[model samples]
Target: MSRKRLLPALALLAFVAGCGANAAADDSAKLSLDAPLPTAVPDGAKIVVGDPATEVALKLSGQYDKVSKYVQFANLSGGPQTTEAFRAHALDLGSVAEIPPIHATWTGLHVKIVASKFRQDPLNHPIYKLGVAPGVSVKTFGDLRGKKIAYSPGQAQGALILKVLKKAGLTKDDVKLVELPSTGDVYAQALAGKQVDVAPIGGVQIKRYLAKYGKDGASTIDHGLRDDAGHLYGPVESLEDPAKAAAIRAYVAAWGVAQEWIDKHPKEWIEGYYVKNQGLSAADGQWLVDNAGHPDIPADWSDAIQRQQETIELLAQETGNKVIEAKDLYDLRFQTVAADAIKGGAK
Candidate 1:
């Protein structure tokens, strides 16, 4: 019954090392350091993590050194819960969708996006579908008018739905919005169970639903709705602390190492996490490998930061809210430090 416990499995990092950014090794010889750089994650530093992917990377790569001892691995359901945990000071570093930090800023929560992942392929993108229950008559965005649509404010579904509506020349006033918890697969389940006429559901959940229900059961809108990027964010208080900030830099660097490792060992990742932990069939796991690629650490934040700003501005406009500047939402210091770490680690 809790809002935070929605899709418990999503936090499992089923497709962990297989989405966004590919790190490749050159033919150059590997460098061996006699001693780790001082910027390496400090010994036994406490950090909180809500993302299973980040947790997997940090642990599997053994990149964070002894800092894992201080980590509290929280199985937060989604961005909304992760944002709440960040606001409550429950976690030092967390990952959430693009909208949560904007909402956090609006609500006076001090948070900043430190790292991000982006995918260029449409299928690779975490595309959310506008689906209707089996018996429902809705087909396109136009049919959504006057219909009861699932709504989870401040989450990706809610934000993306607004964008879809704008493209269709419709607004919330044109549709009956049914508010729901912003965590988990409940929204997808709602549409599948016919509890709502139309809802935003992730592609993976839809794939699973079709695997269970027939292809005709849960119908998806063919509209080209997609999200290309997700963010790893942290509390501003922690980011500003000299020690914690340094630790975060090291964490992002270590993450790059982990991502590089996954890129080279796709089979191990699919067999280990997807098939073993998530129970996906080998074929399905391979499907993920082919679609959801490995994430890369952004070497620079200028362009990505601008894109995040544009997204926030669009969301604000679609929801009839005042526009917010990207400058207010992000801190780019980690980008520089992470670049240094990734370079040093790669060498």
Candidate 2:
């Protein structure tokens, strides 16, 4: 080829490459948080939700069938599984605490929380209590110093440990943090086996932990910190889709109604959810219900957002993660969706 012809060919190749790079950049661009959300769920709209507890609540309340057409409830929960699903585009929405959203942001997966719920009296109804291993002396938070504590970095339980330490006027250097997965009965098992001096244990595991190991000197003490941060979050890409956004809006409202139903119909919830679905005894179910107090879904997320900011700051400091804005992690368009749904009596 002549030199002039070759030069033109190279220029064309460069132009094409630039266009391809720009297209890729557009694909990964962040969705505008202020973008208008469609009020109505379009026909054939669908979302894969990973919230089993909510699934049970909806089923027990007889509200599942109403949203089943557009909502596919996957038997998936926790930060790890939910984040993986989000990465794979397998999950449209996930139920998790504040930590997952923060962690997701840090790991380059932008997510936004669409709904938030807290216990009516969060401090009194904390989701977790510190479980002390047999023969380990940890009567108070101060005693956590120099003791081995179970920690799961990207999980709420691990974040709770850091919060507990902060409340006690201690730092990570003050305690030996034992890296562990806070899944199922792992925390309880670790406590019983004396693998760690302390760990945060919640739900039925709290009762069973003390029951099975109480004689062996295992005990749980209230951490006295409010850890009731429940949220429904999705990847930015998923929430950006108009159909999925509308479906999520509807699901949030139904979720609020289901929560109210559970609070009102404790016996039914205990029987249908804890007893039959989870295989727990009726007594255990009652214990969980009494301890959970009542659900508090606030229309204003100001307080929640402020608390999340503090959490992000703390986690960022401890983990060397970038301190991102907590307000950006929430979609204010959904600020009142659940509350309005509950108020409208939409069963």
Return the top candidate by lDDT: 2
- What tens digits encode model 2's per-residue C-alpha lDDT throughout 1-347? 23365445435433432332123125554334577777788887777788998899888777889899888777667787777766655677889986999998898898889999999988899899999999998898889999999999998999999999999999999999999888789999998888999999999899999999999999999999879999999887767666777788899999888888889999999999998998999999999999999999999999999999999999999999989999999999999999998999774
Q: Candidate 1 lDDT, tens digit per residue, 89-199?
A: 556677777687888787777677777766655444556667777777777678878888888888877887777787788988998888987445787778777778888
Candidate 2: pairs in clash: none
TM-score of 2: 0.90
Please list the residue runs of candidate 1 whose C-alpha ends up more than 4 Å from where it truly belongs after superposition.
1-44, 62-72, 137-139, 215-217, 294-297, 318-321, 336-347
* Candidate 1 local Cα displacement, residue 195, angstroms: 2.0
TM-score for each predicted model, relative to the true structure: 0.79, 0.90
Q: In each prediction, how many residue pairs overlap at the backbone (N, C-alpha, C within less than 3 A)?
A: 7, 0
Q: Any runs in candidate 2 off by more than 4 Å, and if so which?
A: 1-32
Q: Please list all clashing residue pairs in model 1, or write none if there are none.
A: 7-184, 18-293, 19-293, 20-293, 20-294, 20-295, 21-296
